[model samples]
Target: MKHIRNFCIIAHIDHGKSTLADRLLEYTNTITQREAQEQLLDNMDLERERGITIKSHAIQMNYKYNGEDYVLNLIDTPGHVDFSYEVSRSIAACEGALLIVDASQGIQAQTISNLYLALEHDLTIIPILNKMDLPGAMPEEVKDQIIDLIGCERDEIIPASGKTGMGVYDILAAIIERVAAPVGDPQAPLQALIFDSVFNPFRGIIAYFKVVNGEIRKNDKVKFVATAKEYFADEVGILKLQPSPRDVVKTGDVGYIISGIKEAREVKVGDTITHTARPCSEAIQGFEEVKPMVFAGIYPVDTEDFEELREAMHKLQLNDASIVFEPESSAALGFGFRCGFLGMLHMEIIQERLEREFDMTVITTVPNVSYKAYTTKGDEIIVNNPSELPDPSKLDFVEEPYIKANIITKSEYVGPVMSLCIQKRGVIVNQHYLTSDRVELVFEMPMGEIVFDFYDKLKTISKGYASFDYHQIGYKQSDLVKMDIMLNGEQVDALSSLIHRSNAYEFGKKICEKLRELIPRQQFDIAIQASIGAKIIARENVRALRKDVTAKCYGGDISRKRKLLEKQKKGKKRMRQVGNVEIPQSAFMAVLKLD
Candidate 1:
């Protein structure tokens, strides 16, 4: 056990976490040079295209240090705030973490967020300065920032460039020297923590876990503490780029168990596995069920494909336990599922995977956060959809979820960024200068206000120089009201949204204008309006598609032409009164993009 090192890499997005993992794989000979590629640990194509890690991956490496063979288990984690839960779970599975900071961009919001998480896990942190090869690299300055933030000495921080493989070997050596090995008793009853799992058609559900006590061997019957289901281990192995069969997984080691369970949902992440015959006294602590923070309605573009969509979601959920969904229906969009996600990026990844992997076309409603609605009788209920909110007459007050937002950016962009946050109903909490040029600003804001397009706008306002991160603080009492959209004097429930009363007018006006541009002109005039209950705050008119009704009578008398024109005008008036305006799918989607 002393020769084993269990650690993970944690950093902000684009801070060379994946690249460093690739270098480590190559150094340890886990993968041949001919087969190695960029971002080796990132298995999803969407991750490669977006240049971000969405899922946490674990791999085993065999290294030789000072003529002694050392086994290193490295887990690569997502750096985005949306996957902070994933990062936390990965941290719990390891004894130490490599805190990577960009040499050019010193510390970021996610860096601070991840550092706090690592500290909470009580993991030994080895700060590493990455991207030192860049022309703007300021290793010395970043070193000072790390020392100030974590109170570590200067020499303890490692400086290296992941792109050039500089200091890669030294970083590996540091891992062996600084990271403590896993401590467990091989004689104790079996107990393991399932950090991640995936479904396979041939092999069933493969659970990736770290052995906390005793040992696991082939054909051992293990029971999941949460589900209380037992299954014989059909296979036992470690990830050497791919799963390779092993005789047994000893204590303080990481490996996988292929239980004959066919369903992915059977083996839940954060669940404990114990030997069925020689079971442990109790399950492990620090296990948290994944809770989704964002909710949206996903509907098949073709109503007939509803079953296919459900099947796809079921298969996807087997691999991703963080997703939660149930049957939902809308008058405008018909039958669908109300799905919950950790954040917007997680929601987007699931949607893309469904479309690309399952070949299903889906339309998603605007993402929303859960709200607390208080009734007149003192009953409190959770509302995930705006249309589901109870009538104002029966409600005492509404409370919305708030978050503590942290923003790190160049000092020059502070004014614009602060103005943008203020516009989003954010209250400044604290501010500090990280260095001569970088500033850190903290604010308290409603999660609903920023779930849509706050990140995109922040990047734009800061000229792509700002890094933002946030966590849910709690619910706060707010003067919020639901606004509904009306088309031809009929309410559209899917277009309803909850917004603060102060910004109702502007939000309604912007949405009305956007809908007008998206909705195609009909044969009769169409009136699109935004209303709160019966009171209309903003309206837009889409003029009717007029034709030359008198063209055929051009060669005839002027009186005839005037008569035809009058007839056409009367026809339009009748159509306006009786015709039902048909809205396209694009209009519904366009409204979702309105910031």
Candidate 2:
């Protein structure tokens, strides 16, 4: 206990956290030179391809310094804002954090967000200036800014390059000297915090935890405080490269306990685990279940694959508790599941995993935020899909969720960014200058406005130099209406969307034009119309394919040609009156991409 350190690395996306972890592993000789790979901690293929960390991973390392053996437990956390909940839990399980900042890019929005989270957890922070090998590295300026913002001592900041393994050994020594060890009594009753869990086909649920008080050994009966389910610890081990069996995990150490529970949901993250015979008096606090914010419907392209998709989702949810889903049927897309996710990125990753890992072809509907609707009878309900919204005649008002958005960018791109925000119905909250060349602008905007393509547009407008972060503030009242799309006077429920009344005309026109481009022409002319309630806001006509009816009348009387043309005109008019348009899947997705 005297020479043990439990800490994690926190940084913004692409800030070299994974590289720093790799270098630390190399310094401690945890893995051989030939066996080491890039982003070793990022096990998911999706994470590696995207160059981001989505899950939190923990590893143990042993180092000798000053003739004393020290045990160092390093937990690597995701850098994206969508995974902030996971970051929080990881921070809670540690005693210190290494806040890495890019020497070239300086501080970003996620960097500030993560710094505040670490502060909230009341952990020791060691600020490290990383990526010093780059040509644009400016360590001194970053050091000054870190001191100014975080208010730490100037000399405490370490300048290192993760790519070249420079100053990494010094960082390891700092962890031993500066970071404090865990404070817990080995004799006290058993109490551990389960920060993460994974599902193994043969081993059942494996819980990764930190021993807070007392010790846990193999064959010990442990009880989950939240679920009240008891299971004997089949095995106890530490993850040093891989799980190595241990006789006992004493206080102040990080290890895994293999409980015989078959389902991952049984062992919730942040739950308290204690010996069933000598259980603690109370459960641990700050153990809240993860709730998803974004909702969408995902269906199999082949209706027969619905069961396979269901089983795949079930297996995936065992590892990812953030995802919630239930059976749903769509008139246009057949049977599916309405799934909830933490954010857009979370939603996309799950979709990709289902496609690649499960080998299923899926069609995803447009994502939506939850809305509050009040009916005329004074009954209030939450609507997750626009088609579920009650008719305008029966509704009193609707409220949409809003977020407080933070954008940090160079001063040269401020004008264009501000214009784009305003177009998205963003209300400026405040603005301040971070430095001579950088600016921070804050805004309060509807979550729906930014959920579609706001981030991509922001990166484009700022030339990929801006960083954006946002959090839910609350709900706001707005003059909102549901606009429906009609093909030849028939309503299409899947194409319905809720929009602000002020932009109804332009939004309707955009959808109509996009539909016209996507919908294939038929034998009869098609009238594409967008309407709010009974009022049509925009319309476009897709002309029919024409076939020369008189082409067969060669060297015939003029009357014969006229008769044929007359008959063709009457047939077209009848077809227009009773034609049923078949909208392809492409058209449904095309409308979702409308600006």
Candidate 3:
């Protein structure tokens, strides 16, 4: 048998994890010069459009190094924080990980977060300082930071330009030497965690797995270790790691099988596809289900396409397990789906995908952070829809989620950035000066505040010198209230919130204005009121339709207006069916958009 190196490439968003994978494929002659492309591992159109890795994609490559054929199982992972759970599962399938860092940018907050997760998994760590060909390439600086943070030996930091293919072979040699061989057996009951899988129109369900203790072959009756369900695999093959797809994987390696199982939901990443002769017991101990931290209501722009919108949601959710949905009926957007995600980036990625992949125009509510509230009855509150908040008097206690954030930046902006965090209800937990001009600050802040524009605000305040990482910490008791939006004297259940007393006005103003913008011009004047317990704080008017859209039908014009109104009524039917208007997700933007 030839040598095997099983590993996953990990880095922060845009740190060039996929770029390096492309270079590795080219260096191994796995792909022809013409076939090798930019960011080869990013297979999804949405991933290509957004310039971020959303799903973990795995492929195999046949490479010859030191006169030995090596099977390189390359797993490319999602870099954004929202998909960290998926990334962690991807990392578990591997025996080693390539810690790709930006040479000029040095180590970032996400770099640290992902690296620590890799270490905790006990995966052999190989640090590859990528982008050495950039304008301000500082290999040594990045190397030092890797050592300080990751604590890998100095030589393990392979400085390479994944873009220019510089030091490609050196990194390959390091891969062969540094990454440990898989200790999984090909003889025990077939036990492997399904890292990721996708559907093929021609081949049916392609189930990918990392065989831990047994063997699988064509025609073998296989059962999921978790489900203990058996199926027949018509075809078995390994995916040649390339820009395109090929088949044929093997024992003690990463690959996929064309099983007769047609249901895509049956084969999930954390599910184990095993040999029926001797099925393994559990999948993996920490196969976490990722709940989306951000949420938006998705509806079609042209009301007539409501069914198309739900169909699009189903399609998007097929590949993205993180997206959660429920039947949401709003005043503006009728019969649409309320979708949730890990964070803002994750939400944008889904929205962009819905439009690009499905070829549909969408009216999306802005993304919002999930909140938990408490009522005066001492009952624990699970508040996802802002429409659920009770009257202020009915609520005695409420709190927003908090996060432990780590910010790494140049020392010059440390003081300013620190002040900004404090202003956002952040308490400084710790601080460390990494270098003479660089510092790392850890803060415990309300996730509510950090979930907003603070990311952009930090970049602006620090002049692009700062990087940040945050994950959920426990929730804390916060002095907050439920602000509600009443359209034409009727409370729009979906347009309420639990907000800090000090920050409530800003949210009230922003959301009230958003409703005004979304309510659309009407036939009669509409009152848009934002209030707290019947005390109106702000109001706006969406004037009635002065024309009643009654232009002469020069050429089906009257038919068009009637058709539009009929369609609008049909769309309005999705709304409460009582008011002159509906609260489509757009109106939910106040709840979704900022935080």
Please give, for residues 1-595, the per-residue lDDT of candidate 2 as tens digits: 9788999999988899999999999999988988899999899899899999988889999999999999999999998777777788889889999999999989876787788889987899999999999999988888887997699998899889999999898899889988999999899899999888877779887888999999999999989998999998999999888899998999999999997787655777778999989998877675456666567788998999999999788777756767889988767667899897776678778888899878987887776677999998999888877878898889999999999999998899999999999999998999999899889999999998876667767867886667777789899888989988899998886677788899889989998998898889998899999999999999999999989988888996899999998898899899999889977767755655675
lDDT tens digits, residue span 62-149, model 3: 7788788888888889777667766887888888899888887777656766887888889988888888888898877778878887
Winning model by TM-score = 1
**Backbone clash tally for model 3?**
26
Q: Note the Cα lDDT for every prediction shown.
A: 0.87, 0.86, 0.73
What would the TM-scores of all predictions be? 0.83, 0.82, 0.77
Candidate 1 global Cα RMSD = 4.4
Q: Give a tens-digit lDDT track for model 1, residues 1-595.
A: 8898999999988899999999989988989988899999898899999999988899999999999999999999999877887888889899999999999998876787788889987899999999999999988889988998899989999888889999899899999999998999999999999888877778777889999999999999889998999988989988778899998999989999987887655777888889988889988885556666667899998899998888888888866767889988877778899998876678778889998888988888877778999999999999877887889899899999999999999899999999999999999999999899889999999998886778767867876668776788999999999999999998888788899999999989998999888888988888999999889999999998999887666475788988888898999999988898766766766765776
Q: Which stretches of candidate 1 lie over 4 Å from their true place?
A: 288-292, 302-311, 369-384, 389-480, 520-526, 542-593
Q: What order do candidates take by lDDT, descending?
A: 1, 2, 3
